[model samples]
Target: MEMNILIERLQALMAKGGRQILGIAGPPGSAKSTIARGLAESMGRAAVVVPMDGFHLANDELVRLGRRDRKGAPDTFDIAGYRALLDRLREGGPEVVYAPRFDRETETAVAGAIPVGPDVRLVITEGNYLLLDTPGWADIRSRLDEAWFLDLGAEARQARLVARRVRHGDTADAAAEWVRTVDEPNARLIAPSADRADVVIRLDA
Candidate 1:
Protein backbone atom coordinates (compact mmCIF):
# COMPACT_ATOMS: atom_id res chain seq x y z
CA MET A 1 0.00 0.00 0.00
CA GLU A 2 1.10 3.57 -0.60
CA MET A 3 2.19 5.63 2.41
CA ASN A 4 -0.70 8.05 1.97
CA ILE A 5 -3.24 5.24 1.94
CA LEU A 6 -1.75 3.82 5.11
CA ILE A 7 -1.89 7.23 6.77
CA GLU A 8 -5.53 7.60 5.74
CA ARG A 9 -6.44 4.19 7.13
CA LEU A 10 -4.69 4.99 10.37
CA GLN A 11 -6.42 8.35 10.51
CA ALA A 12 -9.79 6.63 10.19
CA LEU A 13 -8.91 4.26 12.97
CA MET A 14 -7.95 7.19 15.17
CA ALA A 15 -11.14 8.97 14.19
CA LYS A 16 -13.04 6.59 16.42
CA GLY A 17 -11.67 8.56 19.38
CA GLY A 18 -9.81 7.39 22.53
CA ARG A 19 -6.22 6.19 22.32
CA GLN A 20 -5.50 3.75 19.49
CA ILE A 21 -2.52 1.51 19.14
CA LEU A 22 -1.63 0.47 15.60
CA GLY A 23 0.60 -2.55 15.27
CA ILE A 24 2.81 -3.26 12.30
CA ALA A 25 4.24 -6.77 12.35
CA GLY A 26 6.47 -8.75 10.05
CA PRO A 27 9.53 -10.96 9.80
CA PRO A 28 13.03 -9.60 10.23
CA GLY A 29 14.16 -7.30 7.42
CA SER A 30 10.60 -6.39 6.41
CA ALA A 31 11.24 -2.70 7.38
CA LYS A 32 8.36 -2.52 9.85
CA SER A 33 10.18 0.24 11.72
CA THR A 34 10.50 2.31 8.59
CA ILE A 35 6.78 2.03 7.92
CA ALA A 36 5.87 2.75 11.52
CA ARG A 37 8.10 5.83 11.64
CA GLY A 38 6.71 7.07 8.37
CA LEU A 39 3.17 6.81 9.61
CA ALA A 40 4.04 8.47 12.91
CA GLU A 41 5.94 11.26 11.20
CA SER A 42 3.10 11.94 8.86
CA MET A 43 0.75 12.27 11.79
CA GLY A 44 3.08 14.65 13.64
CA ARG A 45 2.13 15.17 17.28
CA ALA A 46 -0.91 12.93 17.01
CA ALA A 47 1.17 9.73 16.75
CA VAL A 48 4.28 8.26 18.31
CA VAL A 49 6.34 5.22 17.32
CA VAL A 50 6.91 2.74 20.12
CA PRO A 51 8.84 -0.24 18.90
CA MET A 52 8.75 -3.70 20.51
CA ASP A 53 12.51 -3.87 20.02
CA GLY A 54 12.99 -1.92 23.24
CA PHE A 55 11.82 -5.00 25.07
CA HIS A 56 14.84 -6.94 23.89
CA LEU A 57 16.57 -8.68 26.78
CA ALA A 58 19.87 -7.20 27.82
CA ASN A 59 22.96 -8.96 26.51
CA ASP A 60 23.88 -10.21 29.96
CA GLU A 61 20.40 -11.60 30.50
CA LEU A 62 20.48 -13.26 27.12
CA VAL A 63 23.79 -14.86 28.04
CA ARG A 64 22.34 -16.09 31.30
CA LEU A 65 19.45 -17.62 29.41
CA GLY A 66 21.87 -19.10 26.89
CA ARG A 67 20.02 -17.25 24.15
CA ARG A 68 22.80 -14.81 23.24
CA ASP A 69 23.22 -16.24 19.79
CA ARG A 70 19.45 -16.22 19.29
CA LYS A 71 19.03 -12.66 20.47
CA GLY A 72 16.25 -11.80 18.06
CA ALA A 73 14.08 -14.79 18.97
CA PRO A 74 10.72 -14.07 20.57
CA ASP A 75 11.83 -15.46 23.92
CA THR A 76 14.73 -13.06 24.02
CA PHE A 77 12.37 -10.13 24.61
CA ASP A 78 10.63 -8.98 27.78
CA ILE A 79 7.20 -10.04 26.67
CA ALA A 80 5.41 -9.13 29.86
CA GLY A 81 6.95 -5.67 29.95
CA TYR A 82 6.01 -5.02 26.36
CA ARG A 83 2.48 -6.21 27.00
CA ALA A 84 2.20 -3.98 30.06
CA LEU A 85 3.26 -0.92 28.10
CA LEU A 86 0.71 -1.64 25.40
CA ASP A 87 -1.95 -2.13 28.02
CA ARG A 88 -1.07 1.17 29.60
CA LEU A 89 -1.03 2.93 26.26
CA ARG A 90 -4.47 1.57 25.51
CA GLU A 91 -5.65 2.52 28.96
CA GLY A 92 -4.38 6.06 28.44
CA GLY A 93 -3.07 7.04 31.84
CA PRO A 94 -0.23 9.11 33.27
CA GLU A 95 0.23 12.66 32.08
CA VAL A 96 3.13 11.47 29.95
CA VAL A 97 3.95 7.83 29.34
CA TYR A 98 7.49 6.86 28.51
CA ALA A 99 8.64 3.96 26.35
CA PRO A 100 12.01 2.43 25.78
CA ARG A 101 13.88 2.44 22.48
CA PHE A 102 16.48 0.07 21.08
CA ASP A 103 19.74 1.67 20.04
CA ARG A 104 21.24 -0.26 17.15
CA GLU A 105 24.70 1.23 17.47
CA THR A 106 24.99 0.34 21.14
CA GLU A 107 22.84 -2.77 20.77
CA THR A 108 20.98 -1.95 23.98
CA ALA A 109 17.54 -0.82 25.00
CA VAL A 110 17.46 2.75 26.25
CA ALA A 111 14.84 3.39 28.83
CA GLY A 112 12.44 6.35 28.68
CA ALA A 113 13.39 7.14 25.12
CA ILE A 114 9.98 7.90 23.64
CA PRO A 115 7.34 9.88 25.45
CA VAL A 116 3.65 9.72 24.61
CA GLY A 117 1.78 12.77 25.77
CA PRO A 118 -1.79 12.67 27.04
CA ASP A 119 -2.91 14.54 23.92
CA VAL A 120 -1.54 11.93 21.54
CA ARG A 121 -4.23 9.59 20.26
CA LEU A 122 -2.32 7.14 18.12
CA VAL A 123 0.58 4.87 18.93
CA ILE A 124 2.30 3.04 16.08
CA THR A 125 4.14 -0.02 17.34
CA GLU A 126 6.00 -2.27 14.92
CA GLY A 127 7.54 -5.59 15.74
CA ASN A 128 8.21 -9.13 14.60
CA TYR A 129 5.74 -10.94 16.86
CA LEU A 130 2.73 -8.70 17.41
CA LEU A 131 0.43 -11.18 15.62
CA LEU A 132 2.00 -14.41 16.76
CA ASP A 133 -0.55 -16.98 17.92
CA THR A 134 1.83 -18.65 20.34
CA PRO A 135 1.86 -18.36 24.10
CA GLY A 136 3.23 -15.03 25.41
CA TRP A 137 2.38 -13.35 22.11
CA ALA A 138 -1.26 -14.01 21.32
CA ASP A 139 -2.43 -11.30 23.68
CA ILE A 140 -0.44 -8.69 21.79
CA ARG A 141 -2.75 -8.83 18.81
CA SER A 142 -5.78 -8.08 20.96
CA ARG A 143 -4.09 -5.04 22.50
CA LEU A 144 -3.87 -3.25 19.19
CA ASP A 145 -6.84 -1.63 17.43
CA GLU A 146 -5.35 -2.72 14.11
CA ALA A 147 -2.38 -4.82 13.12
CA TRP A 148 -0.60 -4.79 9.76
CA PHE A 149 1.86 -7.32 8.41
CA LEU A 150 4.58 -6.24 6.00
CA ASP A 151 5.32 -8.71 3.22
CA LEU A 152 8.31 -8.91 0.91
CA GLY A 153 9.62 -11.51 -1.49
CA ALA A 154 11.94 -14.04 0.10
CA GLU A 155 14.95 -13.02 -1.95
CA ALA A 156 14.38 -9.32 -1.33
CA ARG A 157 13.88 -9.80 2.39
CA GLN A 158 17.00 -11.94 2.65
CA ALA A 159 19.02 -9.39 0.74
CA ARG A 160 17.86 -6.58 3.01
CA LEU A 161 18.67 -8.64 6.08
CA VAL A 162 22.14 -9.31 4.81
CA ALA A 163 22.70 -5.68 3.92
CA ARG A 164 21.49 -4.52 7.34
CA ARG A 165 23.96 -6.83 9.06
CA VAL A 166 26.82 -5.60 6.90
CA ARG A 167 25.94 -1.97 7.57
CA HIS A 168 25.93 -2.72 11.27
CA GLY A 169 29.58 -3.83 11.12
CA ASP A 170 29.32 -7.53 10.26
CA THR A 171 31.53 -8.90 7.51
CA ALA A 172 29.69 -10.01 4.37
CA ASP A 173 30.39 -13.72 4.96
CA ALA A 174 29.39 -13.49 8.63
CA ALA A 175 26.27 -11.53 7.76
CA ALA A 176 25.15 -14.20 5.29
CA GLU A 177 25.86 -16.91 7.83
CA TRP A 178 23.87 -15.12 10.52
CA VAL A 179 20.97 -14.60 8.15
CA ARG A 180 20.97 -18.28 7.21
CA THR A 181 21.47 -19.65 10.69
CA VAL A 182 19.58 -17.15 12.83
CA ASP A 183 17.26 -14.77 10.98
CA GLU A 184 15.90 -17.33 8.52
CA PRO A 185 14.59 -19.53 11.33
CA ASN A 186 13.01 -16.52 13.03
CA ALA A 187 11.47 -15.48 9.72
CA ARG A 188 9.91 -18.92 9.39
CA LEU A 189 8.49 -18.57 12.86
CA ILE A 190 7.06 -15.13 12.08
CA ALA A 191 5.61 -15.95 8.62
CA PRO A 192 2.55 -17.86 9.76
CA SER A 193 1.44 -15.03 12.03
CA ALA A 194 0.80 -12.88 8.95
CA ASP A 195 -2.61 -14.44 8.48
CA ARG A 196 -3.70 -12.88 11.76
CA ALA A 197 -2.97 -9.37 10.49
CA ASP A 198 -5.91 -7.17 9.50
CA VAL A 199 -3.88 -5.91 6.56
CA VAL A 200 -0.81 -7.10 4.73
CA ILE A 201 1.37 -4.42 3.16
CA ARG A 202 3.41 -5.84 0.33
CA LEU A 203 6.77 -4.07 0.18
CA ASP A 204 8.32 -6.12 -2.58
CA ALA A 205 5.65 -5.26 -5.11
Candidate 2:
Protein backbone atom coordinates (compact mmCIF):
# COMPACT_ATOMS: atom_id res chain seq x y z
CA MET A 1 0.00 0.00 0.00
CA GLU A 2 1.19 3.45 0.93
CA MET A 3 4.60 4.46 2.23
CA ASN A 4 3.48 5.60 5.68
CA ILE A 5 1.55 2.39 6.23
CA LEU A 6 4.48 0.38 4.98
CA ILE A 7 6.87 2.11 7.33
CA GLU A 8 4.51 1.57 10.23
CA ARG A 9 4.16 -2.09 9.36
CA LEU A 10 7.92 -2.49 9.27
CA GLN A 11 8.36 -0.63 12.49
CA ALA A 12 5.85 -2.88 14.15
CA LEU A 13 7.59 -5.93 12.84
CA MET A 14 10.93 -4.64 13.98
CA ALA A 15 9.57 -4.13 17.49
CA LYS A 16 8.81 -7.83 17.87
CA GLY A 17 11.22 -10.25 19.56
CA GLY A 18 14.38 -11.82 18.03
CA ARG A 19 15.79 -11.12 14.53
CA GLN A 20 13.59 -10.34 11.58
CA ILE A 21 14.12 -10.60 7.83
CA LEU A 22 11.92 -8.62 5.49
CA GLY A 23 11.58 -9.90 1.95
CA ILE A 24 10.33 -7.46 -0.64
CA ALA A 25 9.05 -9.42 -3.63
CA GLY A 26 7.95 -7.85 -6.88
CA PRO A 27 8.33 -7.95 -10.65
CA PRO A 28 11.39 -6.61 -12.44
CA GLY A 29 10.04 -3.07 -12.79
CA SER A 30 8.13 -2.76 -9.52
CA ALA A 31 10.61 -0.50 -7.64
CA LYS A 32 11.26 -2.99 -4.86
CA SER A 33 14.76 -1.69 -4.21
CA THR A 34 13.53 1.89 -4.00
CA ILE A 35 11.00 1.03 -1.33
CA ALA A 36 13.50 -1.05 0.58
CA ARG A 37 15.98 1.82 0.61
CA GLY A 38 13.34 4.29 1.71
CA LEU A 39 12.20 2.06 4.55
CA ALA A 40 15.75 1.49 5.77
CA GLU A 41 16.43 5.22 5.63
CA SER A 42 13.35 5.89 7.64
CA MET A 43 14.44 3.37 10.22
CA GLY A 44 17.90 4.90 10.32
CA ARG A 45 20.78 2.57 11.27
CA ALA A 46 18.54 -0.23 12.49
CA ALA A 47 17.80 -1.49 8.98
CA VAL A 48 20.23 -2.58 6.31
CA VAL A 49 19.43 -3.86 2.81
CA VAL A 50 20.82 -6.83 0.87
CA PRO A 51 19.42 -7.14 -2.63
CA MET A 52 18.83 -10.35 -4.57
CA ASP A 53 20.35 -8.85 -7.73
CA GLY A 54 23.67 -9.92 -6.23
CA PHE A 55 22.70 -13.46 -7.17
CA HIS A 56 22.65 -12.76 -10.91
CA LEU A 57 25.32 -14.71 -12.78
CA ALA A 58 28.13 -12.83 -14.46
CA ASN A 59 27.96 -12.19 -18.24
CA ASP A 60 30.68 -14.77 -18.85
CA GLU A 61 28.79 -17.39 -16.85
CA LEU A 62 25.62 -16.63 -18.76
CA VAL A 63 27.52 -17.01 -22.03
CA ARG A 64 28.90 -20.34 -20.89
CA LEU A 65 25.31 -21.50 -20.32
CA GLY A 66 24.24 -19.95 -23.64
CA ARG A 67 21.63 -17.85 -21.81
CA ARG A 68 23.18 -14.43 -22.18
CA ASP A 69 20.44 -13.32 -24.53
CA ARG A 70 17.80 -14.15 -21.91
CA LYS A 71 19.45 -12.44 -18.96
CA GLY A 72 16.32 -11.66 -16.97
CA ALA A 73 14.87 -15.15 -17.30
CA PRO A 74 14.85 -17.57 -14.34
CA ASP A 75 17.68 -19.79 -15.55
CA THR A 76 20.13 -16.93 -16.08
CA PHE A 77 20.99 -16.56 -12.37
CA ASP A 78 23.13 -18.43 -9.84
CA ILE A 79 20.33 -19.84 -7.72
CA ALA A 80 22.49 -21.96 -5.45
CA GLY A 81 24.76 -19.06 -4.71
CA TYR A 82 21.79 -16.99 -3.59
CA ARG A 83 20.39 -19.80 -1.44
CA ALA A 84 23.75 -20.32 0.22
CA LEU A 85 24.07 -16.65 1.06
CA LEU A 86 20.63 -16.63 2.60
CA ASP A 87 21.44 -19.68 4.63
CA ARG A 88 24.72 -18.23 5.85
CA LEU A 89 23.15 -14.92 6.76
CA ARG A 90 20.39 -16.73 8.61
CA GLU A 91 22.91 -18.72 10.61
CA GLY A 92 24.56 -15.57 12.10
CA GLY A 93 28.12 -16.61 11.28
CA PRO A 94 31.01 -14.16 11.31
CA GLU A 95 30.95 -10.55 12.47
CA VAL A 96 30.39 -9.58 8.84
CA VAL A 97 29.45 -11.32 5.59
CA TYR A 98 30.13 -9.83 2.18
CA ALA A 99 27.41 -10.22 -0.42
CA PRO A 100 27.37 -9.63 -4.16
CA ARG A 101 25.84 -6.48 -5.66
CA PHE A 102 24.56 -6.14 -9.22
CA ASP A 103 25.77 -3.31 -11.41
CA ARG A 104 23.10 -2.36 -13.93
CA GLU A 105 25.46 -0.63 -16.32
CA THR A 106 27.74 -3.66 -16.41
CA GLU A 107 24.88 -6.15 -15.89
CA THR A 108 27.02 -8.35 -13.62
CA ALA A 109 27.39 -9.34 -10.00
CA VAL A 110 30.33 -7.93 -8.10
CA ALA A 111 31.18 -10.41 -5.36
CA GLY A 112 32.30 -9.79 -1.73
CA ALA A 113 30.65 -6.42 -2.22
CA ILE A 114 27.62 -5.61 -0.05
CA PRO A 115 28.46 -6.03 3.59
CA VAL A 116 25.98 -7.33 6.18
CA GLY A 117 27.38 -6.68 9.58
CA PRO A 118 26.66 -7.58 13.22
CA ASP A 119 24.88 -4.37 14.15
CA VAL A 120 22.09 -4.58 11.61
CA ARG A 121 19.07 -6.45 12.96
CA LEU A 122 16.57 -6.04 10.20
CA VAL A 123 17.62 -7.25 6.76
CA ILE A 124 15.59 -5.91 3.88
CA THR A 125 16.23 -8.09 0.83
CA GLU A 126 14.37 -7.22 -2.35
CA GLY A 127 14.16 -9.45 -5.37
CA ASN A 128 11.79 -10.69 -8.10
CA TYR A 129 12.15 -14.38 -7.25
CA LEU A 130 11.88 -14.32 -3.44
CA LEU A 131 8.35 -15.62 -3.66
CA LEU A 132 8.90 -18.03 -6.50
CA ASP A 133 8.58 -21.70 -5.57
CA THR A 134 10.71 -23.04 -8.37
CA PRO A 135 13.65 -25.23 -7.33
CA GLY A 136 16.16 -23.35 -5.16
CA TRP A 137 13.85 -20.42 -4.57
CA ALA A 138 11.17 -22.67 -3.08
CA ASP A 139 12.50 -22.42 0.50
CA ILE A 140 13.06 -18.67 0.16
CA ARG A 141 9.85 -17.57 1.78
CA SER A 142 10.40 -19.89 4.73
CA ARG A 143 13.68 -18.15 5.47
CA LEU A 144 12.12 -14.69 5.43
CA ASP A 145 10.16 -13.60 8.50
CA GLU A 146 8.17 -10.99 6.60
CA ALA A 147 7.53 -10.76 2.88
CA TRP A 148 5.90 -7.93 0.91
CA PHE A 149 4.81 -7.79 -2.70
CA LEU A 150 4.85 -4.52 -4.58
CA ASP A 151 2.08 -4.16 -7.12
CA LEU A 152 2.19 -1.74 -10.03
CA GLY A 153 0.21 -1.33 -13.23
CA ALA A 154 1.44 -3.53 -16.09
CA GLU A 155 1.72 -0.72 -18.64
CA ALA A 156 3.50 1.53 -16.16
CA ARG A 157 5.88 -1.28 -15.17
CA GLN A 158 6.63 -2.06 -18.82
CA ALA A 159 7.39 1.62 -19.42
CA ARG A 160 9.77 1.68 -16.44
CA LEU A 161 11.52 -1.51 -17.59
CA VAL A 162 11.90 -0.21 -21.12
CA ALA A 163 13.31 3.09 -19.88
CA ARG A 164 15.74 1.28 -17.56
CA ARG A 165 17.05 -0.95 -20.37
CA VAL A 166 17.44 2.00 -22.69
CA ARG A 167 19.33 3.97 -20.04
CA HIS A 168 21.53 0.93 -19.46
CA GLY A 169 22.57 1.07 -23.18
CA ASP A 170 20.00 -1.01 -24.99
CA THR A 171 18.48 0.63 -28.07
CA ALA A 172 15.00 2.06 -27.44
CA ASP A 173 13.33 -0.43 -29.75
CA ALA A 174 15.31 -3.29 -28.27
CA ALA A 175 14.37 -2.22 -24.76
CA ALA A 176 10.69 -2.09 -25.59
CA GLU A 177 10.82 -5.42 -27.40
CA TRP A 178 12.66 -7.06 -24.52
CA VAL A 179 10.18 -5.71 -22.01
CA ARG A 180 7.29 -6.98 -24.06
CA THR A 181 8.82 -10.35 -24.79
CA VAL A 182 11.22 -11.43 -22.06
CA ASP A 183 10.36 -9.50 -18.88
CA GLU A 184 6.57 -9.54 -19.13
CA PRO A 185 6.36 -13.33 -19.17
CA ASN A 186 8.49 -13.49 -16.05
CA ALA A 187 6.35 -10.81 -14.45
CA ARG A 188 3.21 -12.79 -15.12
CA LEU A 189 4.68 -15.91 -13.59
CA ILE A 190 5.97 -13.93 -10.60
CA ALA A 191 2.67 -12.14 -9.91
CA PRO A 192 0.83 -15.09 -8.42
CA SER A 193 3.31 -15.32 -5.55
CA ALA A 194 1.87 -12.08 -4.19
CA ASP A 195 -0.61 -14.28 -2.43
CA ARG A 196 2.23 -15.58 -0.30
CA ALA A 197 3.21 -12.13 0.88
CA ASP A 198 2.18 -10.84 4.31
CA VAL A 199 1.47 -7.46 2.77
CA VAL A 200 0.64 -6.33 -0.76
CA ILE A 201 1.18 -2.69 -1.68
CA ARG A 202 0.44 -0.57 -4.73
CA LEU A 203 2.86 2.22 -5.43
CA ASP A 204 1.70 5.81 -5.14
CA ALA A 205 0.24 7.69 -8.10
**Which lDDT values do the candidates have, in the order given?**
0.90, 0.86
RMSD, each candidate, Å?
A: 1.2, 1.5
Off by over 4 Å in 1: none
Q: In candidate 2, list every pair of residues with a backbone clash.
A: 1-201
lDDT of 1 by residue, 1-205 (tens): 5887887888789889888889999988888998888888888899899999999999999999999988989899999999999988877866688999999878899999999998888899999999999899998999988999999887888898899889999999999999999888988999999999999988753
Q: Which 10-residue window of candidate 2 scores lowest in summed lDDT? A: 86-95
In terms of TM-score, which candidate is strongest? 1
**Candidate number achieving the greatest lDDT relative to the actual structure:** 1
Clashing pairs in 1: none
Model 2 alpha-carbon miss at residue 34, Å: 0.7
Each candidate structure's TM-score, on Cα atoms with residue i matched to residue i, is 0.96, 0.94
Model 1, position 36, has a per-residue lDDT of: 88
lDDT comparing candidate 1 with the true structure:
0.90
